[model samples]
Target: MKTKIIYLLMACIFLVSCQNLNRPSGQMTRVERVVSGQTIEIADRSVAVPLLEPIRLIGIQAPDIRQNPWGQEARIQLEKLTLGQEVLLEFDTQEKDGFDRLLAYVWLGGKLINEYMVKEGLALAKPDFPNTKYMERLTNAQEKARLMGLGIWNPNQPMRQTPGEFRSQNLKQ
Candidate 1:
């Protein structure tokens, strides 16, 4: 009876841990370029053979070229994260978005780049998926960076507005 109880408890723990929803066995590949703050084109398209696919780094949104003052900063940081670099790209089970960008987590030197963006306050942890792991940690990092006013959080920086929004707002009457 004692042995059975111990086994049951261990099984329960394993079950709980296994529920983490990230894509298992997602392949690693070499980054070809920093197409955007959250995306990189990869070289090893094993499923499609040399057809470079755009992998969107999961969990964070770097400043966009539009209306986010940190546009340059985001691009710069992302470049630093994976410019012609080799990194592990982990996928979400939901896979590609409607726009066809492959959703993934970019890991470099055992570090998660998506979470790093939030940690460094260069991005926000936009939660579209449930986290079997790392959500709280990501949020805490983003909060700390946000509080410190780093990068995009800097108040004196120029804000980002889209071309449409810019024209509407600043265009002369």
Candidate 2:
């Protein structure tokens, strides 16, 4: 009987630990670090306990840090907008990326940061990802930014590769 009780107690503990593995979908958190224009480290405050997780912005892919002027500009803009700010995170069907980054739609005040980045021409609409909750909105934003010659959209500017293209070539070693 003691062995059975011990096994039952262990099972209960395992269940609880699994629940804590990821934040519940559609929660609010404070941005503690901007990993890039498309990713951030956020601290969940809904629980009595808080934990930090890196969240990749859904539907948009920003320039990589090594992508030169555009990459640096995107990171700077992300920092300016999100560092130390509160954001609401809305998760899609897939909660995490292969890299273990939480995937979310981030809201700063009323603005959607994912769409904002594409709208501002700092990122590209990532259609390849399966979780495409905001793909249409992001694509529209990218089009508008392109027509307006904003950020990386300027025709006179040097051709800037998408983050995916950059990573595919540079990270292929």
Candidate 3:
């Protein structure tokens, strides 16, 4: 009976440890590649074959790569901020989107990369439902960028359409 009890306790402990390991929040990972202005791929080393986990920055949207100068510019800016750097990921209410991409607020060197991108006018504040932990911060950053006439907000050369609109239009073409 004592041996069975010991085994049960050990199993309980193992299960608890597994739960913690599976939690996505507060995970520190290295950026393997920058997919776009608001998305990045991180190396998941937990499995034998390392997989690139794509993470979408919560509360922000960037131009599509085909959106002309803006799209390419956003990608380049995001690359400059996160490519090959270690970043901390903080998960929100909904961890993954329908596309299976992890939805997270990425932090690098104490800066929230999502908010920074909006503030720099490289992206827009786009808060999706159930994942708005930093929505206000991102919106404020975008406002500031607009006021400063930066990037997409430039009075002389503003972006013609939002990233969503651009994508939707492109789909029909």
Candidate 4:
């Protein structure tokens, strides 16, 4: 009887652990739109993708509303890049951030959106979480942009505090 109970307990633990790992894997989906700078829609047959649940372009950091300069332009460019395009999403360890969005690599045609933004000097390479495939590219892009003083790199650019910094400030409270 004790052996049976132990087995049952083990089974229960296994089932619970499996549940968290059951989120969606890498799935190719056409991007319906760029909801915001860090969010996107991956159309699925089960249902239309939720706007609130966005797939972040992992391993890259775009300006958030509270982040560095040119956030508006970053969002605008994201909108332009992803609207009505068929995008491929690659998922890593995190399914999403705290907002329940899907953390994913958004690829349009053959270009990796995360790397492109940084290379254009429109964003910075941030090692946000699990996805780091394009780290080198993102770094190089930011360096080139900074050297050129293009886009947000310009002296007059309005820079916003990063999410990390914001979180840290709040944490001290």
Candidate 5:
């Protein structure tokens, strides 16, 4: 009887651990501020340090702040959508970038913020490997935005270069 009980307990523990492994590693947090079109500062009390954590929205890249109208427009759009809002942060395979910013998919009011930005043409789909969980969704949104000639995709005043390209060029100067 003792051996049977021990085996049963072990089985229960194993099952619980397996379930945890399959669960989505996401957290609920409130947005402290919109850092930019593709980044936001969130309040995460769960962490020991950095009460305000900066999170980079995965699957999209917004124009740099110095990229002129498009950049400012992107930031404004993001602020309107997420400022002071409660968001759910979902992780991909890669959690942090070289800059130590948390990489995540921000979901607010049942909408995926990362995809929304791309769809609105305020940002471009940037598929970084190991974090391509939403690549197809983002790409489709980008295509639709491009077709509609919205925001950065506007033919009359289209963005001259991608944010990455702009940054690289600036670095050379």
Candidate 6:
């Protein structure tokens, strides 16, 4: 009887522990930390939760600090919009990246921060990711920014390189 009781208790604990591991598809959560323009730490609000992984916004690629002024601008903009604020996280078909960061669409009030980044030209639309939930919207925003010469899109400015290119060149050196 004791053995059976122990098994039941273990099962109960396992089930409860799994509850907040993956939030319901469209659940909104508060931001505990903003790691970068593409990532943030979430406040899971459950004691059963493990170490909180920072979430990577699914379809936007922002400049890196190594990109100099542009990278700093993107990070600053993201910080201004998201730090200490509540956001809605929408998970994609793929939950976690190889780095274990949650892949999500971050919504701030009525705006999608991913799209906002592109709209402001602080980031570029990354269509390579499978979850294309807001791809069209993001691409459109990028075009507008390019047309209006916002952020990294100024015609007089040097061509803005994607974050991937920046990293690849760094690796070559």
**Cα lDDT, all candidates:** 0.71, 0.84, 0.91, 0.70, 0.91, 0.82
Off by over 4 Å in 1: 1-25, 47-49, 130-133, 158-173
lDDT of 2 by residue, 1-173 (tens): 99999999999999999988644347877889887878889776667897777899988888888887788899899999999987788888787889999889988877888999999989888873678777888899999999999888878784367777889999887
Each candidate structure's TM-score, on Cα atoms with residue i matched to residue i, is 0.71, 0.78, 0.84, 0.69, 0.82, 0.78
Which stretches in model 3 have alpha-carbon errors above 4 Å?
A: 1-25
Task: Flag regions of model 2 displaced more than 4 Å.
Answer: 1-25, 44-51
* Lowest summed lDDT window (length 10), candidate 1: 158-167
User: Which prediction has more favorable lDDT, 1 or 2?
Assistant: 2
- Cα-lDDT of candidate 4: 0.70
Q: Could you tell me the TM-score of candidate 1?
A: 0.71
lDDT pick, better of 5 and 6: 5
The most accurate candidate by TM-score is: 3
* Candidate 3 TM-score to native: 0.84
Question: Pairs clashing in candidate 3?
Answer: none
Query: Model 2's lDDT to the true fold?
Result: 0.84
- Model 3: how far residue 152 lies from native, Å: 0.5
Q: Can you list the residue pairs that collide in candidate 1?
A: 67-160, 67-161, 68-160
RMSD of 5: 7.9
lDDT of 1 by residue, 13-112 (tens): 8988887644334576788878767778877556756777788777676656444556667777889878888788676566787679888877888788
Error in Å for residue 41 of model 2? 0.4
Q: Native-vs-model 5 lDDT? A: 0.91
